[model samples]
Structures are given as C-alpha cells and as structure tokens.
Target: MTTTTATYDPGLIDMTNEANKKIKVLLELRPALDGFAGIPQEVRLLFRGLRKIESVDIEGLLQTSHRRLARGTSDTGFFRKKISAARRYNRISNVIISMAEKPYRNVLDIIMDYFQKRAEVASLQISMVSGFGKIKLTRFESKSFEDFTWRTIFSKTLPASDFSLVAPANHRVCSVPWHTLHTVGLSTLNWRSTPKYPKLDTKGFDIFIGQTPYPARVDPDTAYVIRYHDAIPIFMPHTISDKSLHQATHFYAMMSNVKSGAWFACVSEATRQDLIRIFPEVTDRAVTIHNMVAHHYFLENSAFERVPGIIRSRLYEGDPSKGIELLPKFFSLREKENFYKRSLGDKHFKYLLIVSTIEPRKNHTRLLAAWEVLKADVDPDLKLVVVGTLGWEHSSITKAFSSWIDRGDLFMLNAVPAPDLRVLYRHAAATVCPSLGEGFDFSGVESMASGGITIASDIPVHREVYEDAAEYFDPYATMSLVKALKKVLYEEGAQQEQEQMRQRGGEVSSRYLPEQIIPQWERFAERVVAERKSIKSSTTTVFEEKNSSVSST
Candidate 1:
C-alpha cells in the first residue's frame, strides 16, 4: 500500500507585521453540553486535538440550545448552579407561549406572538459576554465535561492525558439561547414578509465554527464555518426523532449558510457528496475531514470474566421508582445469580456486540433477526449484547428483544464508559455495524482499534471508511448478515479469518487517530485564513485603483 501526502504551503502569507498572527477561532460548544452521544463525543475529540495546534487560538461558545444565558463573567459553580436566572427567564417565556396558545381573541393571540418575537430579537442583541452569568471566561463548571472525562479517562487505551484541558476554559456565552435565534429567524419570514437570519456578534474572532448549520449569521469580519456532520435528516428523515422540525431546521439553516458563503467541513467524503447532491454550487466551498476516534479504545488483554459484571451493573433495567418495570418474566433472583456466576467462569460465553442507539436507522431489528437464527441453528451458546441509549421510535426494536432478554440470551446495557466498552469490544465474537445509513459510524472503527473484528452493512460510507477491514453484509438481508457472522464467528477457519481482520482493522483505524487527522485540520485552518487574507488584499487594491481614477477625472 502506498500513502500520498498533499503538499501544503504554510507560508502563503506573511504575518510578521500582523498584530494577531494566530488564527482566532470560536467553536460552538452546545454539543459538548450533551452526553457522550455521537455528535457530543466528536466535539470533545475535536476540541482536544485543536488545543494541541499552536497556530490556532480556540475558544468555546458557552451557550445552550434553549436556555438563556445569564449575564456577566463571574463564578459559575459546579452543576451550572448559576443558571438560576436563566431558568427564571425560561419560565417567563414559557408562560408567554402558553398564553398565546390559549383561547383568546384570535387578534390577542396574534398580538402576543408578535410581541414575543420582538422580545426574542431584542434579547439576541445583548452584547457578547466573556461568560454566562458570573462564570469567568477561563474557568467555569461543566458537569457534562466532568461526566465525559470520568467515564473515558480511566478507560482510555493510552495514558490519561489532557485532564485539565477538558474543563471549561477560554469560552464565551450569549444572553439569548440558540433556539430563540432560530425562532426569530423563522418568524422574520412572516413578520417582515422576507426571511431574515439573525446576526451574531462575532466581532473579535477571525473565524466562528458551528457544529452544524447554524440559525444565526456571524459578523461580516468573521468567517463562518460549519462542521457539517451529515444529511441524515434530509435523506433518512423517518429514522430520526422530531422528523418534521428536524428536517425544516436543517434545510433552512443549510440554505442560509450556503447563501452567506459559509465554508463547510464535512465529516466524510460520503457526507460531502450528499451535501453536493442537494446543492451543487457548494462543491467549491465544502471539503471532507474525517472524524477522529478517541484514544480510549485499544488492544487490551482483558479477560472474558469481566464481561458478566459489566453487563450486570450497566444493564438498563427499567426504573422501579419511575413506575417503569422490566419484563415480569425476566431472570428470576436465583436464576440471575446463577447466570452471572456461570458466565463469570464460562470461557465459552460468546456474545456479539453492537454499540449504537437503538433507533430504526441503526437496523437493530435486522441484526436481531440474524442473531436469532445464529442462536437457533449455528451456535446455541451464542448471545447478543447491545450497548446504546434508547432512541425514539424504538418500541418495536425493544419489543423484539423481550423474549431474548427474558431467556437471558440477550443483554442491553446503556452508559457503559469507554473502559468497559473497550473490554466488551476486545472480547466480542465480532462487533456488528448494521446501520442502514450513516455519515461515519464510529463503532466499527473503535472496535478495530480495540483489536476486534467487524461485520458491517455494505453501505457506501461503511465501504469507504472501513474498506476491507470488515465483513460486508447487506443491511436489508438478515440472511446475509447471518452468513457473514457465521463465517467470522463459527465457520471453519474462523480463528484465522478473525485474526486477519484484526490486523487489517489496526491499519484502517489508525487513519482516524488524532495524530493522523489533526494535521489535516491544521492545514485546513491555515488555508482558510490565508484565502480570506488574499481576498481582502485584492478588494483593497481594487478600491485604491478606483480612487486614483476618480482623482484623475
């Protein structure tokens, strides 16, 4: 195999006389507030890598999707304790919305809604503060960061590093929430008879990077860059939650960004092509920069004995306090004890593992069907283990698991930290990735990084990202998956096949490690800044020529 390196000229422009030579970047941190889910996890990884680049000055935009930020840069204690004022403001806003929804004079409702839009617009105009509600610009408490690091740091394959970097530092927040900006932008279409995107105050930053298609436009001097993940909402709408709203928000915001000439950094080549398919003109502005897998997953000599305890502790048994209950026929107290005890020592206990949200697009139902056949015919001792949070439209999928869950042939665990997840990946018979659609599925690569074999759906992204490292099966065909699993799990020469796949996976997964991916980003940042400078210089030269001609006339 041959590797090609793209030549990058870093000295595209002289910066010796520039007051600020470092490119100042403000990255939206809304995704970081969410749990260790897909986009959120990527945000953490991106921040970690960006901090290591010396030429870039990165700061986080400490704002929430729907919650208003309190004013001032002061002490924001742990647990976001300073959000009390923001909470009170939200209560008032909710009251206004509820009143508008009431049976009043149709005229009164219209008038109230109008006033609400005006207020929201006014709130968005608040000057940018270094922090939200007394939180210092460089130091504040983020429970989300705390939770993420706690789960992944100890579980990392490499020595735990960047502990302090994960905390809140060099961040700024706005008084108005991002949700309000979206609402206001949409409202302007009706209120003024023309759509108007809300403008954000990004005065000091050279570039402002958003996690997705942002609802607001940044200052003219600041270049807006969208870290485009995928077009899933547009292409696979039915599989996602809030189908209508999600599609509308994504489409409208995307259109606005395109019209404003924002740069797009796509997560995969497949995703970049999807974007081009919708808007052909954005081809010049969009580029693919694949996602980086965290350093938490790697080859480990973990014993199979640890699997049972991980399953027992992390299994998502419905909460009794919340009036939610698991199946009445689920493992009995004595039966569970024996099952755990037996599995703790049973070297023959083999389970197929999949880590993805239990959503329709993940193709969990199809995987379940294949697992059932594998268990019934090929290997009766085979078990299926699912590790992911329950997503919307998942009732049927969960229903399919009931019988298997009751019989102790299947297990479901949620919030298993990186440490336990690495162990699960290393010891699984094979990690299955049967997503019907994806921009870049992280699980298969993470499994490979952990010295595990992969069985993936033969989708374009999977083929491009996983290459020949995984056994490909048609996502729509249960029998196809069954055959693929059989060849890897129980067929003749299976051990040799698995070993070969693991070796290939190590090479493939290395392409996404931080060291390999960060250089791409650094070059991209430099090029964007250099291009902007070139454009500015050309414009200045044209203006000077026009002035000289006017003086001669």
Candidate 2:
C-alpha cells in the first residue's frame, strides 16, 4: 500500500458558514501546543489539531475519498493511498503533523479547566423571582446550590408550598455563610435602578440567575442568566399581554448580552432550540443543563406502601354498608354519592391521576371532557382523580369542575401531601398530562419516576425528554387523548406498556437526580466564567493597543 498524502485546502470548507460556525469558533480559540508556553495546555492541543490541514485541490479531493476523510474515520491505507495519489498529481503534502499527538488537548482542557475553575469559584449567587414558588430555589439551596449564595423573591399572589417545614433539619440556611436575601412580594421596580435601589452593591456577585430576564434588580454589568421555562404566552396566545411582551423582549436582549459576555444555560435542549428559533442571535452561547430533584424525595418500596393514615382516612371516610353519608364540606351530593359507592368495598379505588393547576394552559377542561367520553366504556371502579388547587381567571373551568363534582365518576382532591402525591403516582394505573404547554413537566416526570405510565402532550419538549417512552397525544385532538387514556386503563398489553414506561422513566430520572445534574451545573458555571475572561482579555488588548498608538502619535 503506497502512501498518498493529499494537499489539504482549508478554503474548500468556508469556516464562516453557519453549519461550521461553532467549529470555526473552536478552531479560532485553538491554543499553541507548548509545555513551557503561557497558554493553557487545553488551548495548545486545539491549536495542534487546526495546524494539521495545510492545502488541497478542493474539487479533486472531493472526487476522491474526501468524504471519508471529512468524516474523520479514514483508515491508514486510505490516508497512505491519498498521499501517493497526491504525489502522482504533483501535489505537495502540505498537511503538518508536528503536534498531532496533542491534537485535541486544548479543546478538552478548555472544557475540563472551566469545570475545575467553577468548582474553585468561592460562591454563586442566584435570584429567583417567579409567580409560583414551584421552582423553589430554596429547595436546591441546601444541596446543589448550597455552596452558592442564594436570594429568592416570589409573587405574594401565588399559592405557597403544600407542606410545613420539617423539624431537626440536616441542612441549614446559613451553610452559604454570605447571602443577601429579600422578599419583594408583588413589587415591580425599574430594571435599570434595581441593584442600587435594592442596595445590592451589584459588583460583588459573579452571576445572577433569575426567572425574569428584566428583573428590577439585575445590574447591567452582572452576568445575567435567564430561565426560559415555558412558551405559555406563545402556546396560548390569549395569555400574552404588554407586560409579557416587555418580558420577552428583555429576555432576548439579556440572552444576547450573556452569549457575548459569558454563557447562558437552559433547562432543556428543546427550550434552548426554541429560544434560538425566537432569537437566532444567541444560538452560539446557549447550553442545556437539566434541573435536579432532591435525593430524599425518592420514596422506597416500603414508604410507597405506607400511605399516610390521614390521606387514606380522608379518601375513605363513609361506611357504604350502613348507608352513612360521610362527606367533606367541599363535596356536592353527586360527589358524595360517588365517594359513598367508591368507599363501599374494603378495597381502595384505583385512580387515573391528573395533577396540575386547573388553568387554561394545563388543558384540564379538555382532559375532563376526554375522561367523560371514556367513562362510558371503562370500568366504573377506577376513578379519574384531578388533584390541584383552583388557579387563575378560569370561571368556566370552575363551573365545569363543579358539574363534574355533581357526577360520580370524577374525584377532586383540592390539595394533597407530597408523599400522598407520590403514592398517587405509584398506584395510579396511568398519569395523564394533557397540557397545551410545558417548560419541564415536573408532574409527568414525577409520575414516570414513581413507576407510572405517562400519557403526555405530543410537544417538542416532551418528545425531547421522554423520547419514545411516553404515550403521546395531541392536546387539540380530544379523540386522541380519549383513546390513549382508554388504552392505558383497559388495553390488553397495558401492564407491559406501563412496565416499559416505568423502566424508561427510571432511566430518564437519572438526568434529574441531584448527584447527576449538579456536576453539569458546575461545568456550565465554569465555562461561563472562562468565556467571560476570554472576552474581557480581548477587549483589554484592543483598548491597550489604541492607547499605545495614541501615545506614539
């Protein structure tokens, strides 16, 4: 086998093209390979890789085995043959291999070094301002973000966390040692003056992460990383308002600045892609890092079996044999009758659980309608348990829910304990989420984690996370949702499908575990810091050069 060294032409591929832009950036940042050099080892490896391509006959190379070479999987024989062929064509082998052994050292170094640097950083400060305390930044404050300084503020309008504080806490708030906390309930302040107005000093912090990009308190110079949870405004156009429009524009602007400055992290790739589609300019800087669940939340088999007596008692209070009417003040006569029948036997009623606030975005009304359609065909013993507090300006939903309450098929638990919710997920025949939109459907994932088959909306984000594991249905299609629900409840292979979903859920759950996701967070923070430093260095160099030139003149 003769050696065929092909003359490599870098120009054959326009590095500036959108397809190769990311690679181009990587190559541009490539470091020189010198152990005694001032540049980082990682950068050195990157430079070595880029130096290998010399010159080439673009068209001729393409006509030969260029495609395979482009793929970076060409065999030694193929490489040798190319070299020999190039020699025959009177083409000089311009490709250099002086530092080929250290080809990818710099790129890997950049990534690893960033992670290492993030771990070294003294502390992180995050500010969470959202309608609901659902994202409860404080929850993670004890674990993943525990080492970081945290500040949280919530809208007083939203509902509070269901459970009370646990006693003898293993984790203390003061673990962070340095934190400036505030609760600006429902107060909307000017974005520009927020830092000074709130007396944050603003200079001490490394990064500011928040739900709203245009927080009244974020300093311009601070690294602002915004959370893009859901496209609720887009998915439900009616939800859009002037305030929302301002928030969206500010979010886009903040994203652009962050991308140019440090880096921006998104909860999911689907969300990151959506953000890119809406604001194409920030595509280069956006990264996906999954949200995490606390370890203590994972209930054991015994814990699952040990349903709180309070929950079981509340669920089954009346004696069916004695014809006793035991009812809560919230239940109507029809609901009371249904509860009476469901409580008749010693055996508990299996439920098809749907847990989400009864908001339009959640599409609860449609789910209820779908459930009604399936009720006639399915077993009467199995109930549709809709658990959540009433939410927002949904009068029609409230009225419909009242009507459902009159019927015997639906059971509504206004609020339940988290452990009880977990039991619901574990025991339910299937958990259905017929939402029109979701940033990250916590309920759906929770159900999956608890070994329940999830029937979710067929949306891009859902598909990205669940992949082929979930039984997807179009939210707009009532028949599709009804069919899926029916299949989950009554199909012949339903048990096997549920088991498969349970396994998939377990696999997917790993990504959300604190142990798995915290390291990724650390890596992301490090990259942002390094990238910011690089940008600052370039700016300083330009400024110094201009100053020197002026002095010389």
**Prediction-by-prediction clash tally:** 3, 19
Residue pairs in candidate 1 whose N, alpha carbon or C atoms collide under 3 angstroms? 74-134, 74-135, 75-134
Query: Root-mean-square deviation of each candidate, in angstroms?
Result: 7.7, 22.2
What does candidate 1's lDDT look like per residue over 117-192, in tens digits? 5654455443111111111222223433444333432212223466655543345555456776677566655644
What lDDT does model 2 reach?
0.46
TM-scores for all candidates: the values are 0.83, 0.58
lDDT of each: 0.75, 0.46
Residue 450 CA displacement from its true place in model 2, Å: 1.3
Q: Specify the highest-TM-score model's number.
A: 1
lDDT of 2 by residue, 1-553 (tens): 1111111123322222123211111111111211211122222221222222221100000001111001111123323443344332221111111112222335854585466334322122223223212111111112222111111111111113301111111111111111121212112233422221121222323444444232223333445455445445544556434446435444443443443343445666766766667667766666666544433234346333343242434342223375522234445778655564554332455667887766677888788777777766676555577776555655577567555554544566644545566677777777888877766666777677766678998987777767666888989999999888777667898777777878888777666765565445444444454455566689899999999999999
Model 2 clash number: 19
